[model samples]
Target: MPRKLSRLTLKEQADKALREMISSYRFFPGKWINVERLAKDLGVSRTPVWQAMMDLEKEGLVEHIPKQGIRMAEMTLQMACDLYTVRGLLEGLAGRFAAENISKKTVARLESILKEQQQIVKDQDVVEYSISDFRFHGLIYDFCGNWLLKELLENIKTRSRPFVCDITPIMSGLYQDHVEAVDALKNRDPAKAERVMRRHNLRMRRRIEWTLTREERE
Candidate 1:
């Protein structure tokens, strides 16, 4: 629940900061992240930095090699596809629950977010769209009323950052998908909402694959 490092314990604060940096692609995949340098950069002691690294290792975002240093985990194409597949399944469940339980006020708020998403996409504002996308999905995760499911999905999403944060795949098609998914929720159609949300994520995997294929050809 704590978004800011100041709200966490010292070790947790270090973990949160370092996790943000890694997930944001500040440390590229497979690059060695020096604990000492990171501590200096983060203005924290090496102890907390080490502690944070351990936490990240458990999440598979980073790994400690024997006699080497901490390196950002390498994301294979298979891993990326798998991550999106699992995300689609989990978020599909979230969508189903949200459709059954979401309030009218929440539906209105989601529509507003979708409107902002449309404008952001039109403007080609990737950063703003990413934030809006997170908010849109996060609301559904919360409204689903399944705390364990939400936590599990959040962890998987965090693991997904190694791929999602670094890629610049085409996103123009997603705005409409978001629109349709929101419309399903507005109609209180659980089956349609789940199908739409799952399709949205699965299509994202395809876009990512297409981007990779093009890169290979290039």
Candidate 2:
């Protein structure tokens, strides 16, 4: 017999479904999401779906219009840069803390994520690789033991979801940065880990800007 799956509450289920939809570009930036249709598709009531949208809104990913419904927020280049700037600082601290605090098991987890990421990139599977990318950074935040830091990072990451594809051109370099971060963490060099993490995010900002510039040129 198969193991029983754990049940999620209506709101939790709704939120997870909605988040995946948004992340996969099912709900594109600046597009209005139909509350009733989403609720019906998710097989949940409007109340829970509405609650989920509100939660995403607080993360700066969605906005509630007075009578039009929920719209996914557009990530302007400035907004992307600002978010990445703060993410660099916060994740730098998180990396420092992780260097001091990450367990051997956590190190193994990070390694596994990187291994998967390598294969994903080799296959040029951006969608699968993006999920691994999220997990890689998320581990550091989770192990950092700073509640506020984790909260802020989570919010910014969610807010940046729509723009993630913008950095695809430099995905290989991004993975290399993750590799260096893991090395720093393994060595437990707090300063090195912090610096590498900051530089990693800074590079992401630069890559996004480059991508935008090329897009404008085209």
Candidate 3:
């Protein structure tokens, strides 16, 4: 007898495959991805692949090019600036909320994340460091107790992953900013926390600007 196919299992498989493709730059920025070839590579049929593409499209990671099928969404300096502007506002609000409502347990958890981040920086493990960076903001969003803000930040994080990952190498100053932000949270100073968070995001925009300038010159 043949094995039964599971819809839930297949969707999960497709989601994971799509995430890997996006994270690894397999579906590289500005490049058209052949869905049929991707389906074959993942050992699935076109149906699941198409489903995964739809999910990615909803997250703004993939674009439908009409006759060209699907392509990775390209990043531009204008997009980066616009994203960072929104992020600064949302994340600054998160920091302020955290300062007001942060528990001792949450502070401890933030410290632990910071310690791990410090080690990753010392080891020069850029990939792990970047993952930790994501987790740090995720923790703040989760602790803020605002479901809507949390979901929005999560979506923006997914959409911005390619640009963020591409710029991880220029993040040496980020660790100190994290430390300062956490310290502000510990002190329960919402204003200070918001300032630190805004400055951190502005730094990210600056890095993106530098990268765009270099690309333009090239």
User: Where does model 3 exceed 4 Å of error?
Assistant: 1-6, 20-27, 37-44, 164-170
Q: Considering summed lDDT, which 10 consecutive residues are worst modelled in model 1?
A: 1-10
Q: Give the per-residue Cα lDDT of candidate 1 at 20.
A: 68
How many pairs of residues collide in each model? 0, 0, 0
Order of models, best TM-score first: 2, 1, 3
Q: Model 1: runs farther than 4 Å from truth?
A: 1-8, 165-169, 215-218
- lDDT for residue 56 in candidate 2, whole number 0-100: 88
Per-residue accuracy of model 1 over 1-218 as CA lDDT, tens digit each: 21333534779889878766754547767889888877776666688889888988988889899999899898877887888999999999989888899999999999999889878878888767876877788889889889998998878877776665422355677887788888888888999889988998888888777766666689
Worst 10 residues of 2 by lDDT: 1-10
Predicted structure 2, TM vs. truth? 0.88
lDDT of 2 by residue, 1-218 (tens): 11222346988878878877766657777888888877777666689889988898887888888868789887777887888999999999999999999999999999999999888878877788777888898899999989999988887777778775555677888899899999999999999999999999999889877776677789
Question: Candidate 2, 94: how far from true, in Å?
Answer: 0.6
Question: In candidate 2, which residue pairs get closer than 3 Å at backbone N, Cα or C atoms, i.e. clash?
Answer: none
Ranking by lDDT: 2, 3, 1
Question: How well is each residue in 1-218 modelled by candidate 3, as lDDT tens digits?
Answer: 11323456776687777775565445567888887776666666788878878888887788988876888888888998999889988999989988998898989999999999888888888778877888899889998778898889877876766774444565568899999999999999999998999899988888888888788899
Clashing pairs for predicted structure model 1, backbone only: none
Question: lDDT of candidate 3 vs native?
Answer: 0.81
